[model samples]
Target: MNALVWYVIMKWMPKGSSCVDFVTQRSLYEVRKRPSKSYSWVAFMLANICAELPWNTLMSVFIFFGWYYPIGLYHNAEPTGAVTERGALLFLLIWSFVMFTSTFTHMIIASVDVAENGGNIATLQFSLTILFCGVLVSPSKLPGFWIFMYRVSPFTYLVDAMLSVSLANALAFCSSVEVSVFDPPSGQTCGQYLSACTSIAGGSLSDVNATSQCEFCAIMDTNAFLSQVNSYYDHRWRNFGLMWAYVAFNVCAALFPYWFGRVPKSAKKN
Candidate 1:
């Protein structure tokens, strides 16, 4: 659901299209006017980066409020009593996500003359990121040759950090349908029969003394489930940091294309 939201919003991010138009028309006009001859291309690029910050930050706040509490993800934070910490982390992550999206869109569009061309390229890349970000498919299950996509996709870190902080340490109570029922050995109680397995595998048994009915939940905790998907609570913060790294990469990447492709030949010679 989050990925879908990201895709929809980012696909039409206005910064890229607006920047394309500004560079082609307004900025060029500025460069042509005699009085604006001293205009700085660097300032134009920096302005774009800074100007999007407040809007994206506000957008992220609204998204966090709408998406976080209504889904009852707050309850997941209760197990460890880190509600405030977890909530703040999630908000920051969402903010970073918005910032990254804007910058990434600019990065893709900066070198293109037409907005539609840039949109097509952005769509293709975003599709690949969503596909390999470990949401649709587990990282462990990815083909060996394509595994690099999972590593390179910024969505991988965002999803990992979000899911790890949101779901880690929460306990799972298996419903009747979710539980596996079996009989203990004739000579032993259910607790005794399954103690070794539970100790190693980590699950709670409903009845210890029951001779015939042994109920088991294979997923003992949220952390255990996360492990199956190759995400860990210990790495959530690291992933958060990596996401900002990608944002930085996007900003730098956008600047490079604009400098090379959009800057005047006279400016380049200088």
Candidate 2:
């Protein structure tokens, strides 16, 4: 089916330049440096790519999918769950793979910047690919993708960001790799609320089942405490891979220091 569609597009496109060639040429021409600073609009991406690998990966994934599915929204009460599920999967898989590819592009530039042949984007890309492989590739909600970003988290987003930055740092050291801090926010969680139970039965709201209520309340409190501590270490102990995962994160983050594409060729230098 895809082949057939491509065949039709190629057949219908104006001759002298086939569909493939047309796109290839256009990409090449557009990417070529110019006086207008046309690529500046995409400068955010280019600059971040040169700086932060994981972050760039996170942001790029959100942007690409957000464009592809502009209405990728999460309802307060997502009906049927199917809508949210589809949106999340699309966001995760598509975004991760696309961004996974971007890591290579970044590494190439990183090595060039540092004048090192071994320090290519491949490792950075690999780390991200592995990091997000199961999480995104597997069926999951988009909100779940960013549980780390949720304000409801016991800690503030700043703390979470610091935790991640730190974890990324640790990864760089253990793996003996240079990690770059380049990712910026690409998607948002929209709105969220965090309300603790202020009263028991009938004080402010309707009476509830004590057994169930206490059980849940206790659970929430425990999770809240652990998540807060996790904020300190970025939940490193959650998995054994953390030993090296943090190592990998720290590796790519070297370029950042501050803790913060597609195919096609180029036309020519302006």
Give candidate 2 regions above 4 Å deviation.
1-89, 106-116, 119-214, 218-270
lDDT of 1 by residue, 1-270 (tens): 446445544553444455466456534644574246655767766776788789888888888898789878889999789999999998888888888877877788767777777777877887788889888888789999999999999888888888887788888678889999999989899899988998888888888898987887888788888887777888878988998999999989988988898666654563
Scored by CA lDDT, what does every candidate get? 0.79, 0.32
- Supply the global lDDT for candidate 1: 0.79
lDDT of 1 at 129: 85
* TM value for model 2: 0.22
lDDT of 2 by residue, 1-270 (tens): 123212322232222222233234334434664334555424533454445446645765655454434432333114434445434443443333334334333334322323233233334434443333222232143257554433222112222222332222221121213221222223311111112333331112112322121211222222233242333333323322323333344336433432223322467998
